[model samples]
Target chain A: MKTRLTGRVWKYGDDVNTDVIFPGKYTYSIADPREMALHALEDLDPGFVAAVRPGDIIVAGKNWGCGSSREQAVVCLKEAGVGAIVARSFARIYFRNAINQALPIVTCDAVDGVENGDEITIDFAAGTVKTPRRVFTFPPLPAEVLEIIEDGGLIPHVRKQLGR
Target chain B: MGKTFAEKVLAQKAGLQQITAGQIVTVKPDRLLTHDNTSAIAATFRKIGVARVADPSMNVIVLDHVTPAANETYAISHQATRAFVAEQEIAAFYDIGEGICHQVLPEKGHAWPGAVIVGSDSHTPTAGAFGAFAAGIGRTEAAAVMATGEIWLRVPESIRVQLHGTLPARVSAKDVSLYLIGLLRADGADYCSVEFAGEAINAMSVGERMTLTNMSAEMGAKNAVVEPDEKTLAWLAGRVTQPFAPVYADADATYASVIEMDTTTLAPQVACPHTVDNVAPITEVAGKRVDQVLIGTCTNGRLEDLRAAAEILRGKHIARSVRLLILPASREILQAALAEGIITDLIAAGATLLNPGCGPCLGAHQGCLAPGEAVLSTSNRNFKGRMGSKDAAIYLGSPATAAATALTGVITDPREV
Candidate 1:
């Protein structure tokens, strides 16, 4: 599976909670992927939906996506066509949920150097991020974990391996 | 190979002789839980036209939030949840004033020791008080669990927190947890189970242990569990409908890391603006002044938390500049606080008590802060705009600090009380 990613990084400030990722009230009527995509980051950034594109990533400081454990926060990003999310850190639940849903979550320090809209590249195997200004190294994933990301999600991957 | 809590629980529930970490396995929970806040996931099931819960007998829903209908929006949310539960014939549905989902689940005996449980609320780890191996999941995950009582878990590495010494007066479990958050930082236990051990943890009461394990989520821990003891068994004897043995960590358990704390030397630690990790000594941020002081939520919105706050606020009133909102986690807590005279005393001290529910913490209901206003709150998260206005500042601390700030209308140490 491919282990490299390059994208324009969207910069978000600290404590970008699940609510800001996916609003609450809109949750009542629709679970369609597009419904959340329309409102992604509406609370935090008004034009986030329009501004983002597929393969785009978000760079944030500590406690990124930290509020209530809502899966839609990830689904919103998924529908927003976010290819990978690289942050300094992630809330444990978001990290787990994002991985489970097959969203690429890369944690790399030196996100400050990767400005918004700057096309950045991530190499999951080498555990490094490369941009115009700097090359940021990250903690690499174990081969099995990389396989989990490669096969899409836990259930699908497990099903395939077991031939079920 | 050494087994993790996840491995053990999954193996037991899957009816397997052996299981490995890194392998795919399904686990049946002894109990399952969801609340009004995450009931939206069940709503998603309605989209798929899942007419019935995957397992009606095991599922439970508690409407702790939006209780008393803060407004029309929340009322509708609760109504939708009720519709789903009634349609599915889910036996464990809890309605208005049913108590914080965590507090009620164990107090009512649904949680059993060594039982693997899942809930939509992140603090479902609170059921660890009963020695249940409980963890929180998101709505889709909850929905998946609702569909199949099995959910996948990556066995987390374990971290041992061997705490020594006793807490000083005025320093409660909240203070101890804050101290741990400060020392360990938010991601200190990322993807790891924090096993609370040592003299201090063993000496703590069941409720206090629950308080500790409950907020391990704040530190991004996978689960925080205390090795059950006589206290846990005794706490369960009267409450549990079906008796169960308490689960204890192995005597020679392996841990990825170990943390030590002397509770006596710890003062109240406060998480400063915007992040749970931005912690510092309260003395550093005291007298910073506040526009609001909030005391309550799933974190510290119980009767004991209220009593602690009332003890600090009884003879004093908040400053004119501050608005103090005290919300009980449930109507039961409210009644207990009122019976203990804490509620009336809090109201007399100029504290506005809201009906039992998660109010300002979500910013969906009451007590939003205006721009430039600062608040000392006991709620779990102090993320920007979390309480309505993005421009407002939040300082996270224990209920005592929240109460002390309510009394002085500025941040102060509860030790002064």
Candidate 2:
């Protein structure tokens, strides 16, 4: 995983749950990861999928991804090429899912400092998010989680462990 | 410092004398649960190059989400899951119509005190009502567990909630859960192990305790538990044939915070539109118009919930403008409700009896809301477009409140009815 990266920001408010992140309607219907990306934020932000470029960051208020344990919520964002998600906080299961999917999830109070379309730089090793105005620091991801992310998610990591 | 329930349970599972919060440990879970998503998990498991599940007996598969195949896609998924279960020689598979995974797990003897359980669904913590340490994991990790039979976990900090006094008429455990969620927003207990205690909690039935632990997921809890008592033993007597020891917190266990509530002054609670934490008392939003009233799902779809709704709607028909839907959590719940004539009463009162499964709670099918419509549901979530159209609104409450709202075609206070 890249330790330092820059991206454009897509800002949102508190409690952006799984259903809105990846609508439940297509849950059973869509099986392909690429197709799942098309419906990302279809319910809440309809313009997101079509406009989101690879490496765009999502800056949101507290408790982002607060509902459902569906991994599709994480998959869609990863497939959409969202560089990282920096929120004030995240629901527990979502945080785990993000790591398993190798998606960067940073928890810190950076929502107020950044706005939509702002250019921001994230240094995972430094544990800092540098915005146009200020720099916000978050506790670094645990070493185990970083290892999983570095190995391209848990599936590949486990595969390596099993000598497959 | 003395250990909390989570620390104690994890310490035992890890074969250690003691463990503290915030430490990481790797342990084999007693049970691994997957529902309709089993097919997806199986696919991921195959990608890991595991020919067979490390231990098939540790797996419990349930087919409740969008059951009976809402379409060809869902049917194909279920078909694949069945094939995987057969290939893996998994004996704990529950086919369609059995029930929601959370309800089916404990009922079928998979969950017991001191068991470490994990599932692919967020409400997996419902099994914690039996004094088990149950938490939800994602599909990827669930696949990993299937392949390796072990998982890594971070010991969560504990939050102690003490409930005092007795609930008044028409108020139930669902109200208590909503009150707690409102008090501690959606992220109040994020990644923390929440323990329910005190007189009001001990007074609750196992089913009611299940409701509390089930909704605890909405507050971002890693898991939630109520201490196992004789009631828990009584409920599991026949189902659980194996002997097990129940774990408890130390007398002076350290906690991040302690909260206490008096149930006597509590009123019926409702989680309003867009968020589960955006909650209010029934009186605050009473009499609001509604197009539908859904009384089922993992959260409040048990026999007691049905009885509560039936008690309010016995012999009286629902409002013409409202569409009332009743779905029991499982086939067993459906059978028991049928035996008690609760089904007949609810049907006679103009409630449409959907099959026992997670109908419309996730908005996959059965009852999708149209634009500009509103529903008063007895489910846990009320997120935007959760029931169907983005413009549609979902207000969540207990079964009694759902029935009362269906009776008047508006969100009504159960006590007033």
Candidate 3:
């Protein structure tokens, strides 16, 4: 996993559920990650995909990814080249899915003052996120969780163990 | 400290003598439930390079969401699910018209006490009604479960909710749940397990208790459970033939928090448009015009819920401007309603009876809301675009309230009607 990251921020409010993140209507019809990326945040922010650049960061309020356990939600963001998600909190299943997919998600209170398009820097090991005006800190990821991300997600990690 | 219900269940499943909140352990679920999501899960399962399912008998797939092939996409998805079931030789598959996965599982004796169940859908936690430890997982994790029969989980801290006093005549368990959601806020129980207790819970029937557990997802609960007792066993006597391991928390179980609610004065509640936690008392929002009324879902689609709606619609006429739709949760409940004349009464009152499935709830098909419309429904969610149109609005209410809204063509209080 990348230890240092910088990106322009895209902000959203609380309770950004899975349905809006990646609507259920396309879950079965669309299988490719990049195709699903086109619809990412379409429901909540219609211009999201158009505005999003690769390696951009999403700064959101609490309870991000609150509804439905669709891995597609995480896949969409990863495919769009989102560097990391910084939110005050996240729904549990989404949090686990992000780690398993090697998407960097940080929890921090600095999400409050972060503006859209603000340049931000994140240090995963140091548990610190630096915005234009302030710095926010979160607890470092558990070693086990970091190991999985470092090995390029759980699937690759397991594959390496089996030497496949 | 003594263990909560969640702690005890995880410890037992992990084969550990003791555990605490936040402890991570691997568990082999007794059952893995799936609905429309099974189509996507099948794709992921194949990607894992598993030639055969780890345990075909343990996987239960139900065709509920967008059932009967609402469109070409859904039809193809259903075909994939049927093929997967046939290939895996899964015995517990439910076809279209059978019912919603959550309701059918319990009706068919699959969910039981002391078992750990995971599903690919969010409301899988509904199985906690039978005192089981159940939670929702994503497709990849579900595929891992199918491939290895094992998955990892972190034990969640428990919030003990004590429901006291009697509900008013016009109010029911749906009102109780909506009120609780308002009090707990949307993410109040995030990543935590909730256990319902107290005299009010003791007095509720098993069907009624399910509402409490079913809506726990609205509060972001990992799972919700009601401890099994006589009512639970009585409800299971004929339905569940296999013996089940019944586990309960110790008498002195410690909880992260305890909330004691008095329902005696609780009014019928409704979660307003755009969010489940944006709840308001019925009196405040009454007379707001509605375009539709839906009286079923996993949350409030049981027999008792139908009865509640039927009582209000009996011999009464629905507003001509309103499109009233009633869907029973399962075939068994639908049949029971028909036998009791609830179905006839609802139709006589100008309601349209849709098939027993979840198409309309999640905006897949059936009774979809047009843009700028408002609907009062018994379903769990009211998120934007939840019922097909982002510009439309959805209000979550009890069946009684839904019936009343159908009659008035507005969000009216059942008590006032």
Candidate 4:
């Protein structure tokens, strides 16, 4: 599935870990998308919750989610309505977690070019990213990786594999 | 082709003995665990339109990061986790008062030898202490595990860290681990399973082994595994319900790389500010001045760790200029320390005791550093701005070194203490 992100890009510096992604304290809050949404990036970027818009992608540097393998990190990103994340490098777990949740974690070297709020389109199938100013092509995901994303992460994929 | 730990584990889980590169091997996790920080993984299942977790008994959720509600936001987050656990019927939902996931998980026996354990936190690899090929996965991957109990991976290569010589009385496994981290650099073991095999490792207690494996993530390695022995089995008897046996790589087992460490004359090592790779002999930074000395976290917050710090703290008070926060990783750990009077001695000597949790480790609350302040911490991760302020400097060391630093108010060798 292809989705377009239209909000201002909320830029963050390097090593945005699970602690900063969703601080440990908020993990106990209600699963109501709004409550979970309110605390997104509360520690690293206090204004992140108020500043983000649905479908905005976060651009990060190497080793994104470097510390703590907390899954709440990804939940906060998804609940904050982040459509996709593009980074130069990602912690192994965060990379797979984002894709399995179908949150669209893509890797690109030119992330430094995309400023906050630059209207962009990420076409999963085309393996390309579009900014009004430039059309950037990303390396296509491997077939298996794409299959998992298309199946909406591992659960659905496993269900299909199991024919349940 | 030679198989890596990740390859062998995945192949077994996928019901196959071998899988080729570029092929998808859907791996069924033998155990799944997460803390409050990444509970969002279970939420990802909802986003993808799935229902209950794949298996309640096999999955566990823990509230570790924000223990005791450092802020209103923390309070709210804890509530969200409770709701998720109750709604999903996840059997092993450890609440805020429970303790750090890393310490409590192994204590409770969720991780077993030869199992493939996954978690949302990078440090999940600490389970490798049990001889499991444990790795950290992302929330979405965790969500997939929650929904279907499986995910795919490209098995990583293996790196053998061979240690020789006996550990000095003052030196513990933390010193050895820091020494290795210093030598290998933070990214030295990246994406590889670091197999620790040596007299020093086998002779160390399970607590020390856990401390070693717990910090494997600091080196950016997938995990650290010990060839489980009597010490491991003793601990596992009361905790693990699953049937298992210790698994070790064969003597002729292939490795992507090998690094040798000789500890006969090794001195106490310290990971200085900004990065865990920052290393220096504790003597070099001593008496420079310190603002805080934190003694807890998943890495080195157990009773034995606290005792090691307290033994050094006995008869010596923390410098008036230094604030020492002594947080055990769990309630049982706290009890052990208290029962042994370690906490009282530490407290009487000017150490502040906090609850058992992952405080200060993430800089969210408790023992944060101010700009220009320096802290000697027993916890893992010494990144810039990691504690509280970006300008603050952190020195990572063993509990003994951390205790010694508290007395001198800067990094120092325990031998001199």
Candidate 2 residues A1-164, lDDT tens each?
89898999999999899999998888878999999999899988999998999999999999999889988999999899899999999988899899999999999988989989999999988999999989999998778878899999999999998999
Off by over 4 Å in 2: none
Q: Give me the displacement of residue A10 in model 3, in angstroms.
A: 0.6
TM-score, prediction 4: 0.83
Order the candidate numbers by TM-score, best to worst: 2, 3, 1, 4
| lDDT tens per residue, model 3, B1-417 | 678889999999999999999878889999999887788888877766767888997899999988788778778889999999999999999999999999999888888899899998889888998999999888777877888788888899899999999888989888899898898888899999999999989988898899988899989999999999998888878887788889888778888789999999999999998888889999999989999999998888889999999999999999999999998899999999999999999999999999999858988789888998999999998888878888999999999999999998989999987
- Model 3 earns a TM-score of 0.98
lDDT-best of 2 and 4: 2
TM-score comparison, 1 vs 3, better candidate: 3
DockQ of 1: 0.34
Lowest summed lDDT across 10 adjacent residues in model 4 chain B is found at B1-10
Question: What local distance difference test score does each model get?
Answer: 0.77, 0.94, 0.88, 0.76
Report lDDT (Cα) of residue B339, candidate 4: 94
Q: Model 3: which residue pairs collide? A: none
lDDT of 3 by residue, A39-91 (tens): 89878999888878889999999999998788889999989879899999999
TM-score of each: 0.88, 0.99, 0.98, 0.83
Model 1 chain A weakest lDDT span, ten residues long: A22-31
TM-score of candidate 2 relative to the true fold: 0.99
Model 1 vs truth, CA RMSD = 3.6
